[model samples]
Target: MIPPSSCGVLVVGSGNAGFSAAISAAQSGAGSVLLIDKCPESWTGGNSYFTAGAYRIAHDGLASILPLVSNVSSEQAERIDLEPYTEADFARDMRTVCGGRSDPELSRVLVEDSGDAVRWLARNGVRFWLSFNRQAYEVDGRTKFWGGLCLRTPDGGKSLIADLQASAAQHGVTTSFSTALVDLRYQGSDGVVATVRCDDGRRHEITARAVILAAGGFEASPSLRSQYLGPGWDMAYVRGTPYNTGDVLELAVRSLGAQTFGNWSSCHSVAWDASASTDPNAGDREASNEYTKSGYPLGLMLNAEGQRFVDEGVDLRNYTYAKFGRAILSQPGHLAFQVWDSQTSGMLRAEEYRPERAEHITGRTIEELAKACADKGLLDAEAFVRTVHEYNEAVYAHRRENPSARFDPSMKDGLSTQSSGKRLSLAKSNWALPLDQGPFLAVKVTCGVTFTFGGLRVDPQTAQLLSPGGGKIPRVYCCGEMLGGLFYGNYPGGSGLTSGTVFGRRAGRAAAAAAAAVEEEGDLVRS
Candidate 1:
């Protein structure tokens, strides 16, 4: 006789992924599924709680699923350029990311099931902004393209997690909040996840047939952040609360000896240091622009030897990609600068982008900006001035081309359009003034990123969690940023939500099936 001590399914997390798994397993007749979140009820991390909650699904491909949403505001959405990278193209990119180590079957599953994920959300009362840029994603089939809607649950919620939490309740899933899962225990079968322990020094024994870990990444854990992402970088989570501690990921890898991918990560460049010191309404994407040595865009980066590297005027994302992820007090260079002009000053003033108490480098001349830096103990004023003088001269002499001598037109535009300190074009400074404008501005900036591009390897089709041995980990699943090694390290917006839906569906289906199969064999609760 099976003891009453065991749950049919134990889900370790309360974020979107964990909630989805619990709800799916419960719906699939798991009898009972318990969700354990290490965080307090209001503060589950993993990017879901404070996420804009806008998901993207195919635009015209699945017109049938279009009518399911109850309410969506196309106007309220961030309508980005959806440049299409086709199914094949996406597969190729993913394959490269995984270094050709992914299962093709899983990839296909993710592509196919992703559509249904949107529909499932609709059926659960989630909504999406209907009017989308459908033609945008089809342009090149390799560029960042997506023609989809911005999704949210009804009544203007703050994030997708709230909607999911409420839905889990509606579906009768049990919740254990503020409970951290410290370890994973398996029964006789290594394939089966048997139990999870809470960090409260209490052992909540799990007699479940399956366990789903939706715990988040290492963004919030300072130690983990330094260990995985590199040191000396302050995590600027300007938005979401700090609660996720990577407990589940630790449980999976360190405890279970599982495999992981996507060791490389990026900070989204601007996003690493840009958030609400001021209202974003006025700051927008322009607030994080790079600065000239005269303070045009202020990212002045140096290497370990204190040698100046990268021109901040270059694409910020490039630095995030190539730089960052270094040791504390010992990165290639722990410092960078952001410089700007009068127009940038106006932008910051319009929104008070800089914190009211922060010291700023404002000058009618580069000498003054350097002096301001010295006043703040940032660097020697003389050396700083000379460095900028030399840099600008090089930029003026075609050492810095209109489009980076190394970057494509789209990449240049993509980067330039996003940064504010950098001129829209090096040639035009209001077509009237230049970085030489009196009262130039500069701000010492920090370079750090939140998550890496590497994560668990999976089969997207079945949403099957794979073992390091290249075999499926039975009764296991992954979604969200935990999806690693796909795309090799590059990311596209909306892809996270896309994977969540796609693999979430597969995980839900598979978990339910696992429960049912065990019941048929008289190994689990038949209910």
Candidate 2:
């Protein structure tokens, strides 16, 4: 169906950010809100449909969020240990992970508004749940939630999009699928004119008092990846919707002179299943986020050269997973193996590492595991065996030096492979254990790019697009991955979704107010 030629607010993209903007615009009294997406109806939520749905927010404690989630019972809540995540904690994480390059104002807004944004999501029909499967570990018979992430939507991103879409519809927002934004031109007080291509291969012009661009980044574009993120990025697997080809971003920059910001050479990449398809459009929507291979934090990773290249336990998986994909891509053949012993095999998230979901190579001993890896593509089986032996010795020496330092996955329990007596060239900083327990398991992984970090700069308060010349564009806004400067070299897991909602809501309300002002001016002119 062809969309109407005009609207109070026109939102491009049908993902979480777009839905948030459309819903908020209608709820904020925008007379007519329209949302459009380049993807078909089946790809309704875009990249958000493939997320684990984790949302990082600052809160008082478990009790603070208990009222919003449905997954925990009174009995379960008693056994759960959750510490308060303060605004300072969130800010520190952003600063640390982004290497102090994240935009100050953007990071501050995201940190301060995170909790309220999550609560707003719950109030708008999105069901919440404690992320026990991904964020918690059993310690001393108690469930300890770690990594400062505790909440998610049930069924992950699938339910998140469903609920948000329902809310948008309930608010009388109209949606058009298979509609691509071709160009956008801001007209100051006259409003904005957008050219869009519909599914029938027809082009139409849409005039709106305000426009919100949430059309995602350029991760799926091979040429853009190679150009912006440097070489070898084009080979990385596309983890989400292939439709985010950066068309809207490019148009905004070319036609509207939107200023781009943040780290263009970095992205939210992760260790993905090596067997996953490389074709941009061939993502297994049914399998969704299960293609992730994030169990490295519980084990160790070895490249084909059979060497431990990175500290797997440098921090919680949330902090390291996003950047490890780059490390893996730099390894030989862009491939690596994650090996775990029986001691920590059960701790792996079943959704990602279950035998049926992941192809695991197992052997009764470390040497046998190395041989199995050799068959898969390990260039040096002997080096693989020697590396394990050396790591085991270091772990043993450290254990002897500090016998009281117990292994704890719930916190940064410094059971590292470093001591006065022995130290590996690269140390596992936490949860280090000897790979002596058999049968050992290994899974091959390659880099998977989730989204790019480079995008248009927008005002932190209003989410309005900022001009290259230094002022906000009159009636234009941006949200989601399209609004850059929040992330840099790496990302803290679950923060992307939260940032999207925070900025999306802001852009929506601001656009609605702008539309109202335009309508008021027209009324006065007519009178």
Q: Where's the lowest-lDDT run of ten residues in candidate 1?
A: 283-292
Estimate, for each residue in 1-527, the C-alpha lDDT of model 2 and write its tens digit: 78999999999998889999898899898899999998989999989999999899999998899999998889999999999999999999999989999999999999999999999999999999999999999999999999989998899889999999999999999999988999887665667998899999999998999999999999989899999999888888899999999999999889888998888889999999998764644467888899999989888999999998999999999999999999999898999999999999988998999877788899999999999998899999999999999999999999999989898898899998999989898999999989999999999998999999999999999999998887887888999999889999998899999998999999999999999999898788889
User: Considering every candidate listed, which one attains the maximal TM-score?
Assistant: 2
For model 1, how does the per-residue alpha-carbon lDDT over 1-527 read when each residue is reduced to its tens digit? Answer: 11135666677666666777777778888777777776666555344554434454443432343365443235422333433434565555446534575456655665555557767776775555432221122224332322233343432224356667777889888787656666666565423543434545565555667766666566665666657655443443323335555666666777665578655443222322322335311112222221101222223343323234443444323222323322212332344445556644653322223444234667888888767765644555677676556545544443234444332222333222222333323232111122455686655544433344556776665556677887877666676656665433333334455666566656776777776666566644334
Q: Backbone collision count in every prediction?
A: 47, 0
**C-alpha lDDT of all candidate models, in order:** 0.50, 0.92
Lowest-sum lDDT 10-residue window in model 2: 275-284
- Measured over all alpha carbons after superposition, the RMSD of each candidate to the real structure, in angstroms, is 8.2, 1.1
TM-score of model number 1: 0.68
Query: How many collisions between residues are there in candidate 2?
Result: 0
